[model samples]
Target chain A: MTDARILTEALRDPATVAQLDAAGWTALLAIARAEQLIGTLAHRLAGLPMPSAAARVLEDARASAEQGRIAALWEAEMARRALAPTGMPVILLKGTAYAAAGLAAGTGRAIGDLDILVPRARLEEAEAVLLQAGWEWVKPDPYDDLYYRRWMHELPPLIHRERDRMIDVHHTILPLTARVTPDADALIADSVVLENGLRILAPHDMLCHAAAHLFADGDLAGGLRNLWDIHCLAGEHGIAGVEARAVHHGLEAAVGRALRLADRLYGGGLRYGQGRDRDMLYLRRLLARDDWGRPTRKLTRLGFYVRSHWLRMPPALLAQHLFTKWRKTAAQ
Target chain B: MRHATTLRIGPVGFRVGSDWRAPIAALNDLYRDYPQPDDGIPDFNVHLFAARPWRRVLRPSVHIGGDFVIPDAAPLPLVQGLLAAEMGMNLQMALGQRRYLLLHASAVERDGRALLMTGMSGAGKSTLAALLMAAGWRLMGDEFALLDPVTGLIHGFPRLISLKNEAIGVIERALPRARFGPRLEGTPKGTIRHLVPDARAISVMAEPAAPRLILFPSYGFAAAERAVLPSETFVRLTQASTNYVALAERGFGALTGLVRRVPARALDYPDTATVLEQVERMWSAG
Candidate 1:
């Protein structure tokens, strides 16, 4: 069947849009008229990364008379939430901050859930306030619940009862495993509150988190985005004491690993840190190799294989995680 | 197969597998060809892609794919098309963020706050998100809004808002400079593209704003006047949200808070211009 036919049949299930191929997408965009592209880009701003097509469209609409209205709503909501009785300290992480902060604007990486880190003591109270306002738990699986309660530092996903937006509230990050425990508490304690009343992790901790997350993934798939986030955060926030702090916390290795992946994938293109320049070059060389068909061999060798070992354990621990994961799955 | 192993949306693809290799390969291709960057592709994030035989389903898998580069394929005319669809809804799950839940919905922003436009198939949500964005609203996303459960903040991933028919022309007339990528005639959504979101919206691209409003928009071109519903009523109106069941408890709490904190409304407008004016007023209210 023709690519169009395949896509047509797929659209029969709107869910199919989630599975479009690359070439299919190019052809699809090529045919869209100027205006239609704008509308589509607006709707998908949260679903995918920003591309030139969508960016161009957005440029033309900036001066539209409607901008002030939307901006007003955003400001008011920020104020209202601050007034809530349970108006706990919240930090807007990742893209949420990036958009407001004006870093990496327009890249389409759909934000699935709004992530907030609240103190564990305030977890119940926060959940209660949200429920009263219209937030609902998205999952009820006991295993999943246990995983979040135990291994994870957050709760199961929550969605807006009416608006359908998903959210994840957290008190900490990462499991308490030996590999991740050292920096967890420090991250929470050192977080910085934004003008919006949300307390986000410090740049050092945030970059470390991104690093750990990328390593856990085993490939450079998220390497570029994560690298960019780190670069921007470091550049914007300044690595002033980041190197010393990262070392003190023993997370320097994690940061190094992430930087290596980024250099290999993006060639250390964006602006970043002075302290990290050496590490960045080392990482670049580590990842640099002959680019074959997909760079699969090089990518796999970069970090996935070694990192997989970090999450591994002896039979007993292995059983524990598996059993824990299985039970969580069962509960869900 | 009980269901297709992969799901395609526009030019994105999502797959779930325990074996690792196949899903990894599939995801690599998906990410390689996707028109923009993302956190869900193979290289985007680490997911527990497993093939355990848990008869009792837990942790769901969500896949979104559109045109990833496909070489040697015969030329065909189309906008954006979905080649397949696969999702393991209501499964036990977690992502790298370790702090938020991901939902399937199109998030559009206005001002500094986000207004989630959610609905099922043919609800005109993608079209609506596109239209509003063209009218000067920020595009948080076309599908999936990553929300922080504690703060109810919305993250913006500005990319093309894929559209089908009627909505296409609707956006065209609203913003003359908008550019489309391509068009495929046979797809259900008619032609699709890496749609151009409003320039201003893109400018403020990755901001996370507190969600102020939840509007369930059902297209009725015949309506002569704009209708605003109470936030409470709008709460009940969104029962059609796909992830409501899975995320019901948390979703309910967040939605209720948003309505009480902000204002929830159901918007019914005949054209893009009217919708823009009505939404603008709602956004302006404190």
Candidate 2:
């Protein structure tokens, strides 16, 4: 078997890690790092015996993930304080939400930017308040700013000047030009409120958002982390009405593909039917990492990059966007 | 990766891989005295690769990549591939190291105790540490000082001493027989050279020392010394640390205990001789 399969097999059954040798553990660590799932893997294999080197790396991963969790939660609280006067319920999304709700998906999760979903009507207000709270626009270019304002789901990524942490104020889950249009209002309406007056998407909606994020938005870079999220979410809150909720968001196919891939990779006892050939391609793209953590299969990566843009925008706009980006690079 | 090597520097082990042979060859030569990691497994992997396919052979530029990377770091010319590999290893420690409280300071040991010198870049800490090592103190590290939180002791990470611009000449004059890497000119940090630590530093690299004195040194100034209070020292050390916040409470406790246990002073001097005298005076006084 190929070295890449070692990561998949280990993730499917953490007990198999005990049987791994020094080389096996090295490959597993590298692949987990490449996939940005080292923290998740560390959590999965917390008690199992492994080599001392692997144990040290995993211990570091666990600590780093805890740091991420603390930072993510603190960012959410700061956003809440900033938006309190605006009277809009602050709805956290993705990693921040998982952390605030203390879900299993959040355990040992590595979070980057703080992703929050605000009402579309209150987006301008949210932007103003965040600015008042010392958040500045990261993309200063007028053209990129205009593009984000017109076509993106989030604000042009505001970063706290003093803290150096970024907060993405997303009005919806998907981009405005994407083919799949999730109901932003229903997402806010169905959000479950926390004890601290913060809100997170309900279980089914959270799963649907994770699926759409994996299959519809990105080019499957860091897809394993998203799949692990789905696996954990499904294990904690079963995928009972996730299909119907995904259909409501025009993301049923993406949700189905995500679940099947997650099950295939993590072996959660969800008996989904056989995935399509295209689903296999997605899996291949996700697993196209070599034992040394270098990316393999350039053709597959490029194909998915183009496909992600295609899913996000129409051909004409996509061409214009690509041209603008190419020009920017050339100028640089 | 066409060529690769593993090196254990103090507590951290690194597996360095390069697309070209020159960097790995240089590393093998420079680190020939160092030991390999236990079981041949590395804590971090450093990859020196070409940004593009043709770039590997055409005016080759080496991009630093590894488990953790700074995405916007500009590539260095292939001639500076050794510098790139060193930066890659440092980058991993700065971003991924959670085992210790990493201080952006230079350190040396004397009589089983450690003396830490920290300041902004171009502050002469590296030169001071190198000169002290030449003057009979054991070199602990030049780039980072690893503070073990549990034991409240500093671990020796005596990697190659990175001497920049003017300090190169000063060190070359002090230790004429010392081994040095090839002079890399016109690099980002300006004419750089790496000095191999003496045999004693490498032989006792595993030993941890109690920090007895902390100095904030600045060069190109009139000779002056001021005692830094514990509160101010705490804040300054936090700014001097890369992983202070990542280690969270353990880091806070370690740093707090260090400042309370050890006295600190800020020293400003006009030249190396004056700084050396001031350091000795402060050491005896402490």
Candidate 3:
């Protein structure tokens, strides 16, 4: 295993923290920050008599994470109130959902932007309602807006004109051009309403969505945090529940891969530490090393950047999109 | 990227890494009087690297990077690398710091009590705080006055006094023996220079001071003063603080406690002398 794997293991181990010096603490914090797990680290290491230097960093992380959580909740509330006019069932996804549902995954996660999945048919109605309620297009570029509207699973990103907050309203999890299209209807239909009048994806579907996010959509930028979310959800749903849910969504292989990677990275020295060595090596190579959690010089981010784009779209569209992007950048 | 140095100012320790030796050398010279952190571990890290590899040799701009970053911030030329480092450090603290309610103010101490003066930009708070320091008042800080959330005690962070424009010349003449950085001209913020804080301030940076006076100073005005009601002061302070909203309820309670106990006065002064006199009078009364 690499230093990141060691740091990942140590993240939950108090005994390991005791042995870490300044350099170790610095590396761990940077890795955790890059992975968006610093808050989780802060939460886990709360009781230990942490050194002032390390403790101060965690304090800062915890404060930032807390602020993000609060802002996310506030944005969700605003979105809920805005969507009420259309009477659309606005199901919160990812961080916002975890937070609204009081899930363990929400504890220290710093949600970047608000993500809410609405019914595909209601997408236009939801967009109009949000617009009238103050959300404006974040990407005002005509081509970009058109690209998102025509080819993407979600509308172009919206920013609350008054609050300056950005939110992504998705009709489905994966992009429309992606190879694997999960049944958005099932996920949306299974959403459970919370006491706060907000809706969240059901336990099994939540696990499936997290797996899909890691394997299908993202470039594994914050893969560790995403895995932690999966870990937390899996713990709540139990292994059988997660397996059944993934099987139902046709994401059993993706879920298994994520679980294996998690075991390799975070669950060593435990009963579930029997991840395949070959899988670990391949997954590690594919992940971007320039990310905060990665420090290995041999692994270049350029390799995975293209791969993520390829995974999100087909070859012809990807080639055309890349060309257009290159031309635009060159012109600028 | 190799020239690096670690130094501590008050409670905060910083590891400043630079691609060019110039910035690191300059920081070392300027901060020689200040002590390094007891432990080598830094509270914050600042990386001053060139934006592009070609930029490292051609035009050579210093781009700030670290644990906390504003991705779109413009790069600074090599000549102003030290300033870039300082700005980067300040940026990280302002954005990342959570243990304290950070106030965008200048501070000075007298008899274990701190005088925090905050106002709009060009308010002359920095200049007044420097003048007070010259008058034997211990300068607690200039850029940020950190108020501990639990105790409400002000931590001393007497970083290099960033005197700009005419304020640079003002301090240059005021203290002949004072150490000052090179007179940098024609940059982002007009002519700029830095003044090394007094050694006394450096030695006593660890000592926390109870805030005794809160002054909302307005420079270039008719010399007049008015008492700020606690309720009004709280609202104004919440605005003055950079991390008040981020810290949420703890910040609210800390600011609330400080405003209630500390007598706040809005001092509109034409010059620094009047402000100094008003501050001295307030301190004496306390």
Scored against the native two-chain complex, candidate 2 gets a DockQ of 0.58
Cα lDDT tens digits, model 1, B1-286, are: 1222333223222333322233344333433323333322321111222223341134422233211222232222111212211112112111211223354567776557788766566767777787776656677777666565568777664445666767677767766777654444665345554465555655556568887776656666554333355554444534533334334455566555555665556666676656667667776763
lDDT of 3 by residue, B1-286 (tens): 3688889888888888887999999999999988776456777778898766788889999998777889798888999998999998898787778888999999999889999999887888778878888899899988889999888899978899888898877777777789899887877888889888898898898899999998998988888888999999998888888889889888989998998899998988887667778778877876
Q: Residue-wise lDDT of candidate 3 within A1-332, one digit each (tens)?
A: 33465456665465678877776776677667666778988887887876787887787788778888988899999999988867778899999888888888898888988999999999999998999999998887888998998788889999998888889999988888887888899988889988766789988788788888887777666777887787777666666666666777777777777777765555532112245556654456534333223335454445556667888899999999989889989999
Model 2 interface CAPRI class: medium
Which number leads on lDDT? 2
lDDT of 2 at B186: 97
Model 2's number of clashes is 0
All DockQ scores: 0.03, 0.58, 0.47
Which scores better on TM-score, 2 or 3? 2
Rank order (by TM-score, best first): 2, 3, 1
lDDT of 3 at A276: 59
True contacts kept of each: 0.00, 0.47, 0.50
Evaluated on the second chain alone, the candidates' TM-scores are 0.59, 0.98, 0.97
Using DockQ as the measure, what is the rank order of every candidate, best first? 2, 3, 1
Structure candidate 3, residue pairs in collision: B1-B19
